[model samples]
Target: MELRQLHYFVKVAKKEHVTQAAEELHVAQSAVSRQIHQLEEELGVKLFVQKGRNLQLTPVGQLFLKRVEVILADLERSVIEIHEFLDPEKGEIRLGFPHSLGISLIPQVVAAFRKQHPNVKFRFKQGMYPTLIRDMIKGDIDLAFISPFPDEHEFVCGEVLLTEELYAILPPGHRFSEEESIKLRELEDETFVLFSEGYSLRPIVWEACQEAGFTPKIGFEGEETDTIRGLVAAGMGVSLLPEMALHYTGPLQPAKVRVTEPQVTRTIGLIRRTNEKLPLVAKVFHAFLLRYFQERIQESQ
Candidate 1:
């Protein structure tokens, strides 16, 4: 029968009196008696027997009561879990970012957010901008920190978190290392160390070189920004990297010089799937990130 019918049966069986069960349920005695009768008729079993002025549960009634109790308990627990899933203060955020950005930015933001919302936890996925965008479109990740700001219509970008100037990383004692600023065209003849395919920064650097009237002569390729910097330090070749790349703590710190001819820069923005409503937790974290970046920008100025 209906769940309400099962509920009435359990209450009446517990109190052993329809009138008292009705009082506890805040309903009329006849209402309770009528529902109990319908339950018995539906189940085709006599659930109660008249014992003096009080009612006594039959053997069948006792068995049914146990099953009904378990059902009601499970339903209550399910409702609680559903509410917790929607609770903003106590939910998980699925965050994505490029390996280059994650080196310093993600750790600082996550730590600051956790201090105020300790109950909130995060599932982090690291990938290049292309991979992160694909995952966002598939609904696999809630939000991402993307560079060169995605142009696809499937994603919405927030305010630029930061814009970093591109720098020329040169080996120690190289001819260009003596200059405060170098033109992109000046490195046309020199070999270049660049990021592997699928990284967003690679295209930005390549385009800048092309705009400067020469395609870079790629001599080596690497994945991590730190590794590329190390390669340049070992005199492998020169590379154009974001200003943030300089924060990498390593013994082999390549000399960094500003790129001036075209003045190349990359903008990073927060992104999410277009037209999809974020979960309460993700929405809260998104707002937090905007504020976090704004504060950092102000402090830097």
Candidate 2:
């Protein structure tokens, strides 16, 4: 079957109406119908069947569609890869990061990078710890800034950029708010709010509490840092947040106290596919990232 037939078939499968598919394809209805018919005949299988007013894929048709989607996606990626190779600086970088980093770090980092490579573009995706790793392995993202990193992965390689400590977030006027640092166990009796299970920070907080000889009584779970911070600010509960999340200023702010007893910390890292080389633009950004964080680390020292 021709590429056009596969395209038409996928469009029809998605729309479930040949007329709509034709409109989207910007082709005549007859042409779309003819190609779908030709594709089925060539494969010796009925790819689609008529429903009440819509179309549906047959069992074999569903199987074929999966393979066709992969083929088409790979073809599209190849075209983009060629274009990127021709003009790396103007190409796009598909980057992924955890939800916690999105609030401030990602925007600041992108803004700083753009100053040096103004022509380059970026497509951002927010994922949890596992999702970010899986995305890089599947070739969906060129690079990612992952946390609790320096994590040993056979399919990806990376370096630790920042090893920032976690702080106990307390509501205003709490007894511990006046302290610069508090032990993990000191908050064990307090109601705790923390990032939900998927986040890398969650486990760090949990284990630190565990080591402190207590199981934290989680009163609320949040998917974002700001949500947890707001909950803490409202006296919903106390939370342990990374150093980066505490630097920003906002109205719903909670007091940040360092966790010194157990010293909760997470590593922020830059990771990429071990077997696949990054696009030219991504490579340049990767280098810049190393230097940027390096400078920050040095300045902090």
Candidate 3:
């Protein structure tokens, strides 16, 4: 089968619905079906079994998928290498970052990159960690900045960019506001404001609270860090936030105090799929971010 046929087949396998796959591929459903059929015929096996409207991969299809995935990844890597050699500074780098980091870090990295490689373009998105990880695995995003590592076995390469201590964002007049740092155990009775589910920091907060001997009383759930801060400032609840998060000004100016009873820290990192080869532009950007952060860390001391 041709490489186009493999591409069509993989897309169908990913969606498990020909119509949906076709839409994602921006091609006609019939065209996708035809190519998948051609691939199956050429391979002398049934790749998918139709049950009502849903498609299921056959055993042979599953095995073929593994091989197809590797072949396609290698081919794509070669294409990236060739394209970069031909036009070093021109191409797209799709990246995702959590809102907290996106506000300041992304702009700095992008500015630095542009100063060196003006022709490069970036497609940036602010998303929760779960959504970012899903997009990265699907080959939709080249890189992501997320807190606390996920299963490292699944990704090809990743490096922790920065480690920041977690602190409680309290109302301006809260009892503990005057304290520089308070232990996690001291907040057992305090109402908590936090990011909604799917946020990378959620697990960190939960785990820290559990270690402190009580499940937090979640009073408010928000999508953005600033919103959480607003909730805390309004005395709706308190939140655990990263130190670096305080760098960005939010709508509400909550007290940024340290968590002391049992201090917790979160490491934010950049991750890419392990099996896929990163393009030259992505590699350069990754290196640049590391260097930039390293310099900042050194300068602080």
Query: 273-296, model 2: which lDDT tens digit per residue?
Result: 897767777888999999999999
The lDDT of each candidate is 0.85, 0.88, 0.84
lDDT for each residue of candidate 1 in 154-236, tens digit (9 for 90 to 100)? 46655578888899999989998989998889999999999999898899999999999999999999999888999999999
lDDT of 3 by residue, 134-235 (tens): 777766678898777664656546888778888898998999999978888888999999888888888899999999899999989988777887788899
Could you give the candidate ranking by lDDT, starting with the highest?
A: 2, 1, 3
Superposed model 1: Cα runs more than 4 Å off: 1-87, 155-157
Off by over 4 Å in 3: 91-100, 123-146, 149-159, 171-173, 177-180, 195-199, 210-213, 220-227, 230-235, 246-253, 270-278
| Candidate 2 local Cα displacement, residue 125, angstroms | 0.8
* 10 residues in a row with least lDDT, candidate 1: 75-84
Per-residue lDDT, model 2, residue 84, is 82
| Best model number under TM-score | 2
What TM-score number comes out for model 3?
0.78
Give the Å error, residue 184, model 2: 0.5
State how far residue 90 of model 1 sits from its true place (Å): 2.7
TM-score of each: 0.70, 0.84, 0.78
Candidate 2 — which pairs collide?
Answer: none
